[model samples]
Target chain A: MRDKTILLVEDNQDDEDLTLRAFKTNNISNRIIVVRDGAEALDYLFGEGAYAGRDLSMMPTLILLDLNLPKIDGFEVLKRVRADSRTRRLPIIILTTSHEQEEVFRAYESGCNSYVRKPVDSAQFRDAVRDLGLFWLIHNVPPPESE
Target chain B: MQTKRFAGGLRIALVLAGIFLALASGYLAGIREAQMKASGPALTRDLTIVLFGQTLHLRLSLSALGVTIIFVLTILLAAAVLFARVAHRRRRQVEAVNRKLMREIGERKRAQDEVIQLNAELEQRVAARTRELQTANKELEAFCSSVSHDLRAPLRAIDGFSDALLKDYHDKLDEQGQQHLQRVRNATQRMAQLIDDLLSLSRVTRTEMRREEVNLTAIAREVVTELRQIDPGGNVEVIISEGLVAQGDARLLRQVLENLLGNAWKYTSKQPAARIVMGTCKGRNGKPAFFVQDNGAGFDMAYASKLFGVFQRLHSASDFPGTGVGLATVQRIIHRHGGEVWAEGSVGQGATFYFTVY
Candidate 1:
């Protein structure tokens, strides 16, 4: 069991499943908590609404965000995360289907760690997930509080 | 001078009237004196008769003078009043017409100035909007670059891992496993191509234009010659008019011809004796219009509106292999040159694409 946790905030069900499947196929067993929209992702991070009973100290080691969502959107969620002292330094990668330049600029402006586009093919999708999993899960050293 | 003339005539008439009136009064007084003298005379009847005749003559002359004076005075007074009224009316009419003309000129000037001001404002607004659009396009291109770069990393991984699987697990897996890996590679390749085409299309928007006088005829002939060299089997006769000069970016214009000619070649594959004509024609606005006409498998007229849109393909993938950005890129190039392009075609007939380089 990996000690790190990943929060995958994606609106599309197929995308969420594909992400999970990629991790499972790559043998990356990090605990990934999936949220369907930006609002739920914010809730999980701030320990509000449905996640009120959860412990605030055990925040996710990494966040994979999608720009388009049902409510709140990725930029707003990122802004809120950066504003909070607990999650200010958290590694947030914007993994979205939109290759629109404005979305990427907005993500970077809101203090996102990196931006990535989702590939169309299933095989390429798996590979992208594997590289990210290897980098964050193994090589990258998380902060002391996250550990 | 006019007032002096009028006053002189009035003074002459008044003096004549005064003299005539004085003569008439004197005649009347003389007649009375003669009558009194006749009453006082006791002797000389013949002398009395002579005096009476003299008095009668004087009376007749005085009556004539009185009548003449009244007629002259009335005529002078009437002439003076008539002249004054006609002069006043003529001056008033002239003043009214002059005021109306001046007002009309002022109004026309104001209207023209307002139109000029509105036109200036409209031009300013258009310039500002064009700048905003340019900025947005630049940002979009940047985003496409990021996408292309990031997407390539994953594509590399997919092709690499799949190849590894094929090399290592060749003995363990059967024919079906090899086919699956090949499919994976093919899919990755197609995806890569799509991304690359998108990147190219985005790049077309940002490339700075280098403008110069280009001989479109020479370019068209060159493109056709190249095509002929590649495929010697096609019996396509190319007619290119010479020395057609236009102002444009040479490289971009060359690309435009390449795409258009390349399309002509692909569509005319079925015709045994294909006739391709590249020359200049008169445009809608009386400008020189360059055209590439070919006897090929032309598209339907209904889908002409979609020809310039990015990734808009009229033909199926099986019929034609392209990212559907050739005509779109052509349009962008011509549009950058401040020109326009349009295509005319029928379902089973040939197509002619015309463009203007302004």
Candidate 2:
């Protein structure tokens, strides 16, 4: 259960609430650490700034990353995370509102585990978030040395 | 100009020499007296002679001097005449060459002027097109991103919170309130579909095209398979012709077939037995056109022209739910491939969409 922690990086408050509700509705009982921006996400991941005294060994097993963010964008965050050995093997899923094909290709090219378009329909969005949670948390096998 | 001027000078010199020869031979006495003084002993000796019964004191040396003078003058005159003729011929040749050069210069000047005019026109056209493209591109970019990010975000919140109200406040609210929330959710979903459809239409215009040998039959079959998966209860009989191939972007062409076949499947929902046929046949202009024929709720011929216009629908939302952008997208993609699309249908009969790609 400790190793099944999740990191959710989202900017919009409504989307954040909806995502939390989706996980709760789907009965995914993993501990989720939410970050408002890409900078906070990096800080949380590296245990720097606001999270300086926090233990670095307890890394989140899965990350739900949003493409559009303030202070630092999603692509940059993905690059910096993949560059570091500590968070390199973490499963990162891109959840974005953009339906652009070029953006999708770029996200995959930048090394995201999965890409999900945040559908405007509530049920579809909820279903998508639930599927991502179930697959990454319970079913799919993470890298052996990731923890 | 130099050759022509040189020829004129030579003619003037020739004419002056001719006047000098005339003065010396016919009227100039001082020149003849000098010639006689310069004669040698044999040229000066004169003898008595009789000619035609008239005795004339004829100095033999004098006759010899006259004959010698006459012979030299005749030779000089003949040489001058020959030189004049040669100079005239040379001048005519130079004049002819000068005229040819002037004509060539005129032609080159005309060609250069034409080229400059053409270049100016082309530059103007290019500038106009660039400005138009820039404006269109900027507008499309703003519209697409705003709709993708901003518009959908609010709508999703509304839908999500509405669902929450229905789920969490189920007992507090009356039955009608729950039903109203459901209606609101469905309305949001429909609006989301409209947004998606608009985005798709924009993408049809914006997406870059890659032409290849696309197996159209394979695409149609795949679309049909997906359609069947989406609606497992659909019992429509579909018949696709063999070896339907085209040179175009496969993804766009797949969208084309999907929209057409999807519409066919949708309109034929009320029919007991629906039949759809996809094949190639000659179009109205006698060109080979790929057609999708379906026995469905057809349209009137008078309103047919409005079918391909964006947001124009012949059927009501209750009967045939659509954003009315599918046919417009199909037309745009077909036009992008240097092709055209048209449809023919009579009310209560069926609809057949014919498209040709080059």
Candidate 3:
């Protein structure tokens, strides 16, 4: 678990900092990799563009996805991830600030494992992160490695 | 009107002329009879000289005068009877036509009255519908405030950075500074909640309703389960009757139950043995009604009317944290279902919300 990596796909810098702070305060010491947009997230996942020539077998333990991003949006990324045999079973969780039910339903429909809203309250946000880390990082067992 | 009068005058004049002609014919016949009587003596003298087998000439003249007088009187009487018969027939025809005209006029007047009455009724209906539309328009305007996307984006920025500052720089700030930042965060959160609620209320109005058979019992159970998850320690005894169903937009009805049950959960937090019930009952108007009753922080009856208005609150935020838009949203949903919702409660007792869906 300590050697596992966590990928964060987000565009907003403040949100990224807040999420990083949440992880640090919760004592989650897993390696967190940040990508600024959906395109970068896909590139990192598929070993293309800037992430080319990287080891393909070293996939992240968990993916924290944001819906609103530049170049490509999160839903498309989720679809592409699910389509590929290599990353088909990756545990992807949607973390967004949007409170729209349509967007939430769309995220789930696109094959996300969990959906969490980024609360405006800092305390609530911290608690949400703590609970998420405890469950996904410690308690829940992931799928087997891809052959 | 003028033409009708002229026709009536012409008919009267034609009848009068017929009567006058009859009288004149009678007068001329009388004159001819007198003349024949005056010439009788001359005729008798002449006949006695010419015809001697003239012994009977005086008797023959007297007999011929008698016969001539009788024949003239019979012809005059016959003519008078024929004229009288013609005049009587014409009079009867005129009376029949006049009776027909009178009946037609009465029928036309009645038809005109019916048209006017229908026009008045149409006007009244149009006015009533216009008034209803105006009221709905006003409500829409109130719900759709001018602060849309532009306002919300800046608010998000303020909230996000303030949170960042508080979390990242907490050790640098004094106790007073920390409290100030916390207050700022709280205000921003409250403002965000208000904006979200207003937007949701407007959405309820704008969206079209899709009606389908919805199991209310299942929806209520789901909402209660979610509520229990939120407040797992609260020992609220929730009773939901089985097989309760209605026809409405499933999503919107779910929202209604969520708001109602969420309120029940929030208000009943203080009660050690809180009781909540969701079931169906007969409404005051004898319609099937769904109700949510809770032994919670019930409000005063005097302020009940304000419960469903946007941003209208009977309780303070210190006691119960709310944006005061949940019931307003519920009312909008019920109304969209062509239904009505009302609440009944007393201070320090309990509250029950009743609604009907058609």
Top candidate, metric DockQ:
2
User: Looking at every candidate separately, what fraction of the true A–B Cα contacts under 8 Å does it contain?
Assistant: 0.00, 0.78, 0.14
Q: Please state the error at residue A133 of candidate 1 in Å.
A: 3.6
The candidate scoring highest on lDDT is 2
DockQ of 1: 0.03
Clashing pairs in 3: none
lDDT of 3 at B241: 97
Between 1 and 3, whose lDDT is larger?
Answer: 3
Tell the DockQ for candidate 3.
0.13
Distance from true location, Cα of B140 in model 3, Å:
15
TM-score of chain B, candidates 1 onward in order? 0.55, 0.70, 0.60
How much lDDT does candidate 2 score?
0.87
- What's the residue-level lDDT of B281 in candidate 3? 92
Best by TM-score: 2
Model 2 lDDT per residue over B289-331, tens place = 9999999998999998999999999999888888898999999
Give per-residue CA lDDT, model 2, range A1-147, as digits (tens).
466888999999999999999999999988999999999999999999999978888888899999889999888899899999998988999998886776788788888889988988888888998889878888998886644
lDDT of 3 by residue, B235-277 (tens): 9999999999999999899999999999988999989889999
TM-score ranking, high to low: 2, 3, 1
lDDT tens digits, residues A1-147, model 1?
335999999877656766887898899998999998989998999899999988888888899998877889889999999998988988999987665555678899999988877776566677889999899878888767843
User: Model 3: per-residue lDDT, tens digit, A1-147?
Assistant: 336889999888777887888899889988999999999999999999999998888999899998878899899999999999999999999987765655678899999999987777677788898998899888989888855
